[model samples]
Target: MDVCHYDVQVKTAIKEQKAEAIVLTDDGMNLTAFWTRLLCGCGTDGRFEPVYVMENIIPLFDKSFNYEIVERESWFYGEYLQAFYTPEANKIVIRDDVYERALAGVALDVITIAHEVVHCIQSIVMRFLNAMQCVEFKTAICSNDSNEMQQHELQTDRITSLVLSPDSLTEGKTDNEILQQYFINPLIQFVCGLIKTAGKNLLEALNDTNCYNEVKEVERCAV
Candidate 1:
């Protein structure tokens, strides 16, 4: 198993989802604002509507995933918990308190929701690999005790940080420059590159009729 290749694929999937979300907006004028809300949830003073933000995200998953957003009083644990993604139900649950906080101008909830969205993408990739009968790779991803899972979680955190702090990557800095200035781990570049590729593939797969059934098969396995 080429672990580097797998990491790249996962990261690409994430980037593809983000790109898809960006294009969903009308006139593409809100690109920066959309990312801002997603990353930092800053400056949402009547300027950023959560509904529109969600609308952009929900479509990134193909129909087979049955992605739904529900606001509940408590999801899983309790009030301290903000949100979670359930693979079996194919649902993303946002705690009412978190929603309220966002409504009251809290940016952290936005980042939390985005993090859960990354989990959704992870679930999708895992299911896709399972459907393709890549047993070894699937096992690597699904095994709870594996170091792969820990690294994946860390990678997700890094990607989330980069997305929220776009300035680090886009402020006339090369990937190397950003890495040094931000003190980002060297492994993150590989992960980030893979995410970019996976995102492109995911977007293509979402639209291709031939891949539709394969995606549906993955969804079936999840249930």
Candidate 2:
């Protein structure tokens, strides 16, 4: 499918609760709730403070994969590669420079680690749940088709953002504060702001066939 249809399908999946495996929460829950579950697993106490994902969450979940740092020349992407998850080995390899920056508390680099962790979840948890068989989930994880690849990258980025700084958790927090506290990218924070602002209307539109049809028409025209 083209990007537009792919987008509509994603919205439809989210609305239908077909994305629960990836969201890690029930339908209609805010991103904060999703993050709570993802970060704390089943032992959450309702607080949404940032936690050490590698130390606390991953270990709690028994996903004790090693972080392997390698030279840039180790991958085809070279220096452009921040980090990547190897499903066969169940290990996440980080580029040397990215690892160094993450050690120094660089927000983006830390986010890169979280991004790879999400990739691990996709390969391990989601696959175990049989979610990989779904076309939407498959496309969002490892499809090679151009449209599917875009969806994959988009889903990874969205999951990373949701894990880092959920909308409800951003209350009264400035962009810089969110960056320091959540390691959220400025672009992700801006997009989260728009989504939070439009959330009510977006939910209404999803539930109203007429509104959904109008959105389709707009998408068609734009295409």
Candidate 3:
């Protein structure tokens, strides 16, 4: 069975292994969607390997112009990079429904591609949240995570919003559609690259900046 279509094995994996969440595809191109996410570099790499990205997703109708989304059957634990109480499989899956978006001639399908990818980034950090207990890993951890898993999730959503702000995507597609599918392009040029904050915050790494900030922020905000 295709990854886009939920089959018995996939269903069993999600059920028995505790798949966290499944996002709807912008179109039936969920595989294309995820594969597109896999290419971590804005430009091509010499050897052509994504340094960091979501798993098994790509794009299909980029030049064609189409968009859609998919949904998960149930909610499971685990954040971005780590699994909480999940069973065995250590990966994420996004499903693409058969709907394509088109405002007669407009769609933010490209940007939404990145937006959904950021959500996967959220799940990756949630796992760290589970491990770190409570921490804030912003900076290079930009795509990795920001603050507490939940807070970081929300903040990253905000960041994604800012990156794909309505105006940023309005050159061609509708503002609303671009906004819906907005996301930050992972620029290795930024101070917030993934390598900057690797392995700093495990559930047990409370002394780390991300962890300390998490504590301080939690105490300060009372969440």
Candidate 4:
């Protein structure tokens, strides 16, 4: 069985080996913050400018994030698959139709890019963690590890919304205002609100600027 799917094994590894215990829980917040700061440098300037999808996000993955966008037929994944990140190839593959809709500013398609961006972020951090010798942490992030794939996916979705539409940045705006301002899909905004209600601490931690230590540490060690 894939140990990545089993939180018990990860916990046992952390306990027995005394690892720093960086996994997909609180570290997810840190990962999101680090990437957001790296991409936009918005909050650090004290202005907290909102990130633009077309101008900021697309170019982010294209250039700074070190991932190439490859477009193919929509049915390449046998239909219904819009986009995905391939860690080995370091590419974000988008279906042709989805790519066109994103270019056309379709809300859902545009947000799809954000989703894969999180996947790319997770893959980078996970690889670095593995190199740092968190051997048990390796399989949990495997794309083929069906055990916790859904959990990873859910966290990725939530983190995508947090990056695109942080409550700290968009405070006092109604749902409609957020949608227009952030270019976020309506469903994503709604789910973000629901999660904001369910987990106040997680949201606050992710919005914290100091929470990027994991990413900074990874960069430092990689050099």
Sequence-dependent TM-score of model 4: 0.46
Q: Write the per-residue lDDT of candidate 1 for residues 13-123, one digit (tens) a residue.
A: 433331111111121112322233333344322243343344454455445444344456323344444665555565666777676676676788777766666555544
lDDT, residue 164, candidate 3: 34
lDDT of 2 by residue, 99-118 (tens): 77876778888888877777
TM-score of each: 0.43, 0.46, 0.25, 0.46
Model 3, span 54-147: residue lDDT tens: 3322222112222223443331222221112121233223233211221122234323344545554444433433243232233222212223
**Cα-based lDDT for every prediction:** 0.48, 0.53, 0.34, 0.53
Candidate 1: how large is its RMSD? 18.4
lDDT of 1: 0.48
Each candidate structure's count of clashing pairs: 11, 0, 33, 1
Give the Cα error of residue 86 in candidate 3, in Å.
9.3
RMSD of each: 18.4, 17.2, 17.0, 17.9
> Per-residue error at 91 for model 4, in Å?
0.8
Model 4 misplacement above 4 A: 1-23, 34-38, 42-74, 123-145, 168-223
